[model samples]
Target: MNSEKLLAILKLQATKNVGDIIAKKLIAATGDVEQVFKESKNTLHKINGIGTHVTDSLFANENLKRAEEELHYIQQKNIGFSYFLEDDYPQNLKHCIDAPILFFKEGNIDLSNQKIISVVGTRNITSYGRDFCNQLIEDLKDYNPIIVSGFAYGVDICAHKAAIKNNLQTTGVLAHGFETIYPKTHKKYISEVHKNGGFITEFWHDEQPMRENFLKRNRIVAGLSKATIIIESAKKGGSLVTADIANSYNRDVFALSGRANDIYSTGCNNLIKNNQAHLLSSADDIVKMLNWDLSKTSPPKQKELFVSLTDIEQKVYDYLQQNGKQLLDVIALNCDIPVYKLSSILIQMELKGVVKPLPGKLFEI
Candidate 1:
């Protein structure tokens, strides 16, 4: 893009009170990003959602000066970037209403004909979470999906490392600018990450990794993928926020279930219980739900068709077979079993291949 257009986008990005949605509105109203500045305050005010405060911020001289300085920095460094309206921008993120209007990227990152998913979770990852994250990435390597994450501790870095070990591309979404790396120790992995995939961020060259920036970074992680997976999470954390954002974008979400008493598992269990995410037990669940091509890769082994079933399992299996598909609550009611007991029974049946779990607490024979 030309310096003028790039400067205009930077100014719009720097403008206070003007978010991605508002910036897009201004661009649409003027019919061109550069033209937005050319239009008079009166003309710009005619656009819906463009109030006096927004107009004031848009025309602020400070914003222009900052944009010019950043533009020069970008030009001198020969940095790469993608505009929301451009074809090179991530297609999945382009559909998000709150996606950044412009963002910077680095390395051999390529999204063309790629299957992407974001793996995220609590920074305090347990042994189980780490094992599952590694196994999940290794198993999915054959499909060659681009793994996306925040590049923070625990699950994020674990996902990135697994992808690297498996020779799969991995993208790190950052909260700070390219001028500095957060968690300074992660600086060691930068060269390797760039070699395999790379990093992306909306923050300017000098921006710091503020508290709110991490929350903002979560959106990019969620928006760039076809699905978001929470390997593990606390009762409340940024990973859950990303899952919510993915759901808002109408993307598939999967949560790994853990023991109910485990503190880290509480968030994931709640998501499954509330029907906010699919109960992820294995890689097969993702492949099946996403309808990925099983012929191209070695599929996971299925349970024996003639496996024995317990008396309760037989009763639930027969109920599911007769009903076709039923909700967990409904299944418990109809089978004359309590929900707590029925959950375990259903899980056993699922392992036996006599029952399958679907979205929304649904089960099928």
Candidate 2:
């Protein structure tokens, strides 16, 4: 984008009371970010959701000054950024109603890959959560998914490191600005993260990491992916907030189930019990639910020679062979297997070259 347009976007972003939704409304009404300023206050007021306070803030002298300063810093540092309407902007995030109009980024980040998933959880991660996060990424490496996390301690950092170890792209969404790293201890991982993926933030270069900022950051994490996985979370925490945002966006949410009595598992258990999130058991659950394996466009191969199958797997394979092709739910009903268990079984069968998934969740042997 040109300096003039970026400056206008920054100015609009700096305007108080004009958040992403209101800013977008203003932009749409005026037909351009710059036009928002050119239009008279009376004209802006006529736009729905536009009130006196928003119009008043739109032209604030301080906003323009701050915009100018940030714009200069952006130019001097040669920073990377994407406007909401730009093609380079995250595709999944673009669908969100309240997504930021612009967000700054650093490193070799790529969003063209649609197989993205955000994994979040408590900062005080247990060994079990850590092990699960590691194994999940390892199993998903072949699918080449872009792992996303908050870049905090515990589960967040664990997910990023696991992604890096598995040689998959991993993005760290930051609550603060690029100028400062939050935990200071995480600074060492910055170079590796940049080498593998990068970092994204909606905050300006000098914005501090505040309590409220973390809450606001959760939405971006939830918005940028097709699914959000809560590896662990307390009854009240930011990860749960991300889950809520993801659900609101109509995105798939999976929570790692733990014992009911476990403190950190309470939030995930509640989410599962309340029907807010699916119970996440293994990587196959995600692979099946998200249809990641359905990307195979080639013709379905016959079952591998001399391949061994468990009794249940054999039952499912026999049913599919006899029925030709059938919907997942239908196959589950006929085979007397629960949908959840059937999903995992189908994935296992697919990996063994016994069956392939068609569009609309149909499977054939």
Candidate 3:
């Protein structure tokens, strides 16, 4: 919010390839960033990483003009902006060495909240994945932890929608920028998020949603939250990147287990095997890992039923509950029910609030 400090920092950020490290070094020695800009090349060259290319960039009129234009465009949007050196920037994020000097934010989500959790998973979610994500949202909303997720398909979209449905605040970390929504069909959902929750990115106004941007975006999503839940993921996906970043930040990363042979669950299994993530069998597991105050999390009401059930629904439910997590196909085979019939039955149970869906076609009863 400090315009002078923000503009100064953005000015540094605009210097191509002379990013956080070089900027910090120059700013520290000069005692003020603006002072560094005023100094001659001889003074700039005294710094360890300040070479000829950086010196040229430091004095570039074009870079300075672009920075000013970015600032002007930001103001025109009426969006709230912050600088890392200024007050009201997220304290946790500021601790990172590569923290963005500038952050563009506009929405109702509060970053200063006492507790936050990031939920991420596969875009190709299974029925079980859906139910799993729903239960997490339902349980955590009353406690008011800020839900952070990539606003993509599957679990990310589900997490955001559930939080909004419960009137809870959430934040979506986008790979691109405000210029265009990726997975453009999600425009409606992202639109709702802007009004209710918010969208965030480290990218500039018109940055493309390149394949690599998603990996970089995951760093912010992971860095911003206390913990991350990966409901389902393949051996390779953005969710794995988020988990790795969370670990690097010393945040707890959790991967819910699914079928052993299922490709979608393979990344999660590898995470657990390689010790990047702990297994999250239940919502309580996540709560306990974060050491969150149990009292603040008031789960939704559930009717205790002694109602007798036919052998199939009972079989399916028992399989899920006993294993703590199960995919629909896995459950169907285990319960000896046909896959088609099991689908409808699981849907009914989900509506009844007995089971939860997860990413990568899974369910937990």
Candidate 4:
């Protein structure tokens, strides 16, 4: 068939016993995908995680046709891929073990960059998060940086949108395939991204967006960039996954401060406390990390913060700012308020024009 190296890689990705167990082991023993097929089944069993059945499949190379089919489908969709050893691959991401063997992309982006920062957080973002993202990315835009993110919701959308608005290249790594975009609502922005920036994925076409894919996607978000910034993430947010990956990769990760006692902000604060991430209150912190000379590009126009309040109101306001619209119960949990008295406070806050209720029992600030 005169199959090429890319085809071989496609087949390797198609093999059995390759799901999180023996994929790395086989790569270690065989030294690469092509060599894995060359090794005898008996010989392959010597690797730590590989078993007789896995070695047998390694010898038979049963998935070659499946891979060829996948490659054909991938080609039909016009998705592009870059191997770790290929010239087009992001050199920084190459060092990551969990790095995709092939990155499927559709967009305009200078994949090669002096610096990249992955900005991520919750999908239910607040005005504060929106403001933080706007200011932080605006400052870093002059660096002509590549911004990496998952392109999901909340902070990811904000980051990508800001980068595009600033005319900076932004890459959104996807959890699903190019064949289908999860949360199709993002098509407008993602299309614009492809026109300028690009979308990337490891999974081939027809791959479902299993929740784990998001976890897998976060590694690329963390690895592809020089640093990672958490604008507003909850205690168990996926942005923390990116931070964890960044720390593992020995990359710089900055987290913006959230209001005291807010669940969404607790993750960033904990990251700062554990010394896993540095504190970031303004755009200056990000610029300092890249050490870029911003005199080159036009400085980003800043946003105006509307209204002010005392500490208690600020706390309530800040909580609303991160959660977008939340139910009264959610508000209570977020603000750590006893349900009994939270209603009067919320009502007062609403009257003050600090928060407003929406249909379906939600409030936005």
Best by lDDT: 2
Candidate 2 lDDT over residue span 1-365, tens digit each? 89999999999999999899998898888899999999999998999989999989888899989999999999999999999988999999999999999999999999889999999999988878987988898778778889999999988988988887666799999999899898997886788789899999999999999999999899999999999999999999999999999999999999999998999999999999999999999999999999987456334434235878999999999998888999999998999999989987886575454776565789988
Clashes of each: 0, 0, 15, 2
Cα RMSD of all models vs. native, in order, equals 15.5, 15.0, 8.6, 10.0
* Local accuracy of candidate 4 as per-residue lDDT tens digits, 1-365: 23476776777677665653356566767787678777777777777777876665644545777787887887677666777666888888888877776667787867777678889998878778887787777666656788888888788977887787666788989898777877786765666688668888888788889999999988889889888999888888899888998999999999988888887898899999999999998877777776866776566545435655667778878888886888888888878888767776765565344676554668888
lDDT of 2 at 56: 90
Instruction: Give the alpha carbon lDDT tens digit for every residue of 1-365 in model 3.
Output: 45666567778878876877688788888888778788899988988878989989888887778778777878789767666767687777777776666677767757898577888999998767877888777766656678889899988988887777556688998888688788896775655687667987777787889998888788888878888889999999889988988898888899988899988899999999999999988877877777877576676445345645567778877777779888878888888889988887876565445676665788886
**Segments in model 1 whose C-alpha atoms lie over 4 Å from true places:** 294-365
Off by over 4 Å in 3: 1-4, 296-365
Model 3 global lDDT (CA atoms, 0 to 1): 0.79
What is the TM-score of candidate 2? 0.81
Better of 1 and 3 by lDDT: 1
Instruction: Report lDDT per candidate.
Output: 0.89, 0.90, 0.79, 0.78
* TM-score of every model versus the real structure: 0.81, 0.81, 0.79, 0.77
